[model samples]
Target: MNLSIRWKVTLATLFALACGFAMAGFLAERSLERQELAQSHRNLDVRTEMVAHELRPWLRAHAPRFTDPAFQVLVRELGAKALARITLIAPDGLVLADSAVASEHLPGVENHRTRPEVEQALAQGDGSDLRASQTTGERTLYHAILLTEQDGSPSIVLRLGLPIVTLEEELSQLRRHLVLAFGSAFLVAVGLSILLARSLTKPLSDMAAAARRLADGDAAARIQITSRDEAGLLGETLNRMADELRAKIEEVSEDRSQLLAMLTSMVEGVMVLDYRGRVLQVNPALERMFNVTRAEARGRKFSDVFGHPQLALLVSTVLSTRVGQEDEILLSPSSRCLHIEASVAGGEQENEACAVLVFHDITELRRLEKIRKDFVANVSHELRTPLTSIKGYVEALLDGGKDDPDTSAKFLDIILKQSDRLNLILEDLLQLSKIESGQVLLRREPLQIEMIVERTMAMMRPLAGKKGHRLVENIPSGLPLVNGDEERLGQVLSNLLDNAIKYTPEGGSITVAARHVAPGGSPAGGKSESLEISVADTGIGIPESDRPRVFERFYRVDKARSREMGGTGLGLAIVRHIVEGHGGQVWVEGNRPCGSRFVVRLPVQPSDQAAGHPSLVPTK
Candidate 1:
């Protein structure tokens, strides 16, 4: 019923006091009454003995007749002397005498033989009983005895009884005193219990208020210590606990600050979502990655901030099942590849738990991984081919072909040719690696494109003549000077011219053209900041779908034809690396009217790193 501790204590005390008083009063009354009765019984025993002594000799002399008046007189006389009522009962159930009754009424009196005291005395030598007297109609306590002959034959029963009026009155007086004492003690108990309840409950109430304040985040709440008792000790303990709690909170706050700083400063994009899948907080990295602000994202669903369907589903799965999830997702529009890890944040209650997502941009990493894998597979296949041919032909020569001098010489020549192809492939691979790894330092200088293209065509005219073709150079006179590494740029021009000569058919033409281009991806007729160079050949043109990957290492549209032409398959790849190392671009497209065209665009100036390295001048 929401009873206060004060009332509970007071009522408990009063109830205990009431029960104790009632029980003690009852026991005390019973004890005193029994003692008084025992004293009365002892007095009656003396009287009974005196009467027995007087009648014993007479009983031995003769069997007395109770009808005798002398015996009746004797009973009346003994009762008066003992200040009690005396009775004499004959063995034959006759009430011979009762001192309280007149002599005439003795015969009319009820049979004394059947009385409880008389029956008990005749059966056992002594007996006592307490009942209302039959003749006097007063409450009496009775003691009785039997007298017998020397031969042990019972002769008569003598009994003495006294009224218990004084004992009962004394009991009544004790009960009155007990009631008065109980009433006075009950009043005192109530008063003292009320004071005790107040004393205990006041401090307890203060402690409760302090506890509520502590729970509400008030660190200053404390109970006032009034005494050095248990209550005061409890207050001191609670105060100490409050101080410790404050210190712990400060420590937690400092730790939180450090954690927030770390999250903000980290490079990996991080976001936290609540139980309902709404954004709780996001670090600056995540905001920058997603183009979202904290104010706009907070309290909004994760799907809103992260528009990718797969990422949203991952967050939902972690929230529902509390299992960690990770996947690579392509964030569209920008097409960034992100590696995301989603996991549930810890909390004591399930509802308080949240989800944390971390994202890392792996687009460059994935591109490099794909490049490495393709390089390994293609290199293995390319190396295996020439080795197989050499092995097979050598085995043929060993298996009796060597017995013929012409066959043995032809086999040796073919073996030598294959060996040269292998050496060319290894050399190209090593050169490509050096350029890509920045070991081949560029030598930048002002050079004429027209002069460079002319020199490259002159070097390639002989190879072009083998296919019944002639090399053509298309360059304007007095062109702008290009700032680049002469040897690297010459290498780029050489590889393109070599590919053109190898692929062109008999009677087909090869052209090396140079022009100018603006940075907006359009050709400019006059001098511009960049120079565009083209190597065109009337040969089997690359398909449009295969154009994008033409410059990748060992990528070929027709592998058998390129291998047949003594091509190492690394020419275009090396061309691309060299052109890009000079901070330029290379791509292939269908030439006008007939064949494929490979274009190279280079800036008129180079990066500051080109000037930082040692320079190489063009050899005249």
Candidate 2:
């Protein structure tokens, strides 16, 4: 049923050629029959004239002798040569002669006067007919003429007839020849039709195949036809169209690759949404920023994936207004601050338009901004308090206190103390800033833990004794030497001891201890030894809520009492920075029986010198 064009065309052409050849053969056969019949009629007419001329003399000499031997002999001779039937009749409708009959049979011949040819000849001088002969009972052609005498008087009717079978035989031969010729021509026509159909359809078929290949993604598919016909032109057009399509596809593919690369490499989160506010595409950054995968986000609503109502609203607003909108929104679960910009990103039609949302996380920037504000406020307050004291003391001295030596000296001392406190605060602030900025270079060397503790305790013992607090040292003799800056490590111990002494009451006990800890026992794991030092005191312990922030710059649990006791509130902060700079950890915990304990852990040196130091006190 799926016939190719070639066979269809070939079959159709062959059918038409067959019909034409058949019709031509029929017409040619008919024309040849007519021509042969006419020739036969003319030959018979000539024979009848000759026979009539011969019989005229006979008919005039013996007008009534129809059975004469001379006449019969003459008719026989003429009929034999002409291959025809001859008949002669008198004007009285009596049989005269018949060439086809014997002499004895001639007498029994029927009257021929009423015959169609004879009757016609009598009436019109000459006529012809084809019919079955009366004498011979054979189908015959009859030609008749009215005979005339020398005086122009009609004497007898001369009739001539030839059998139609001879003309039919000749026509049959011509018909066979015509049929053979037309059959041959029809066969040749079929071959020629097949060739012509192929010539026309071959190029079209090739172009059709090439077009199929092109559609199937073969960019190089082409038709090889080279004729100057319409099919050839069509083939060339198809090839050109294929080339243009291939180039356009390559260009589009390259553009897509470049666009994908740009989107993947961008740091900002980007999402594309349809007109219905559904997610169409989300880049990797967007997936990561929103904590969702592209598969999970696709086809879902933007608000559902992002879980940010403000961002979803912005997208809707931009889509409705056909304008760009930007706002900062906080993303939940992670509570990240993001600056999001939404814009319409398609054609002019509202249905064709899509929303593009681009955003970046600004949480760190926001946190730094808050820190800057707090630092400025704290610095202003710290500077103002000391300046206010100095200002008040100077004002008192100016109000006649200078006239009294005692009053003036006392005012001057108060001013000096406030000025010293401000200087201490400024120095502590500068030190903390240097350590935080990574500008303070550490002298990293191995130092005995007990020596650092002993130096710190020696400095702080007098202060503890002034408060009647008992000072105890419980350092293990074989404690490992820690890797650190010796002076910075000593300051760390001194600060903890000083805080303990400052916060403890009379009769309270203060203890300093150090121990060598294995790698697994130390918080900093993996095959590294450590040294842990603790300063414990029976004092008003730090609340669990304030412990985490106690090490922050200028953070104080008891601000008024710390100031009254000549504390700058930055000592613990400085201790923390120094310890962390040496890759150590410092933390505070509640001491047993009602006080707080501050502990420091530092990585220990692996050298043999660490094993030979003298212990400052026995382990207890």
Candidate 3:
């Protein structure tokens, strides 16, 4: 049966007490019965002694008579006085008289020679035996004596027996008295046992409840110590344990909070998985990276969450080998590249470990690496083209083409032109590199955008006329002054017009427009005004896909056409660097119907750096 400790203890105590009392009562009863039996033996011994004394004279005087009434009568009288059965036996195994047997039955009595009491009396002078009487069929305690003469000649064998029932009757009365005393003591013990049990179990119950409270995260739970006993010591120990547990939990909780904060703030995505590959925990960063909620990600399989087989296999390998593994996985749709490091996260025991996958986004880094590779290749190709042309013309002049004056002159001019193209390419490359590397410092002066545009168009007009293109100016009068370097701003307009002049078809219109833009709300919760300048051309326009990257170094929409037209791809890159150096943004769009529009947005006031000249400073 199910039982609380209190009842169980109480019952156990009562049972032990009951068993002890019962054993004591039994032992006492046995002792008392033994003592009573010993006393009865004494009484039997004394009575037999007195009867033996009286029968000694009679035994010496008369001869033993078998089956005689006189002898039986004497035995009966002696037994009445002794309050026991009496038997007289001859030395020759004859029963002369028996008080329990009739005179006629005495003649038919069994031989006394084999009887234990008779044989013992005949041999040892006296003996005692407690057994059932063979003659009377009654339980009797027998004491026998051998009557002898002065000469030591054996005369009569006398045996006395008392019924065992007589001793039992007296013992029964003692038992009733013992029962009364034991019942009173048992009642007292039961009361005392209940009180003791309550005292002991109440503290244990309190401790158990407090333990439950502690398990439930109730740090305030405490036990009240009342005594310095074992139970009190236990309670005190428990209290101290609770305090330590609370402290450790708080410490671990703070550590967890810090860990969560770190994970949440990290740019790298982190995920934890169990041995079964089920997601255990996901931080906010991972949630954002995967575009899934933490709740939805948890308990889902790693393969299911990432849907990348190679990544899943990497995690599996780490789990199986109990080692660390790392790989780069490319995410589709957005084309983001992530470097994942997976490691076993727990003990070495089988299936006890987890896979901790830390994902670092390396998309930008990879893109930069590719750009570096492409730039090296493109520079080689761009340099190789003009070098090949110059070498061909010089080799032709040295190979007897120089003997023909006209051919030699033409070849020399071609070499010079190629050399000049190469020089132009190198100068543009140097300027682009200087602007990008923050080596060029721009002058910060409030200048008129109209003057910069007008000067750029004027300088490029002869080239535009050669191409038969019409140059149009769209600057509004009274335009706001722009804070920038005059040289850098002039370079920006010159590069745009150059690109338009080179790319525009003959007789196409090339327009340079300028306007003062209103203040747009900034992300910093502030307002700032900017100046917008756009160069629009009615030429073969840049494609929508290629516009975004057109300002990048060595980028060209029509590579063959640009190289044929002697256009170094570094021109627009230099313009972008110069414009952004002034903390401005530059972009290109479709001019619609035939060409592209390149727009530059510069703050009316100079910012941190014209990045067009990163070393620039603004003057009032």
Quote the lDDT for 325 in model 3.
Answer: 90
User: How many residue pairs clash in model 1?
Assistant: 0
Which digits, one per residue and each the tens of the lDDT, describe model 1 over residues 327-426? 9898767788899998888643433548888999898898889989989998888888878889988999989989999999999899898888888889
Candidate 3 weakest ten by summed lDDT: 611-620
Model 1: how far residue 158 lies from native, Å: 4.0
> Which lDDT values do the candidates have, in the order given?
0.83, 0.82, 0.84
Better of 1 and 3 by lDDT: 3
RMSD of 3: 4.6
Sliding window of 10 residues with minimal summed lDDT for model 1: 611-620
Query: Which of the predicted structures, 1 or 2, would earn the higher TM-score when compared with the native?
Result: 2
What TM-score does model 1 achieve against the real structure? 0.58
Model 1 regions more than 4 Å off: 1-19, 43-84, 99-108, 123-125, 132-139, 145-156, 186-423, 442-490, 506-538, 578-620
lDDT of 2 by residue, 1-620 (tens): 88889999999988887788778878877887678778878998888878776766766776556567877888889888767777777777776777778878866877887888888888898888877876667777788888867765556777777878876777788778878887888788888988999899989888888888888988889899689789888888888888888999999999999999999999899888888777888889988887889999888877777656777678778878878898999877688899987877865433343878888888998987876786687778788988999999899988989999999999999999999999999998998888788777777566778888778888888888898999999987877667667777888888888889888888899999888778788655646777888889999999999999898777789888888877888899889888887777889999877899998988887676555543231111
Pairs that clash in candidate 3:
578-612, 580-612, 581-609, 581-610, 581-611, 581-612, 582-610, 582-611
Candidate 2 vs. true structure, TM-score? 0.64
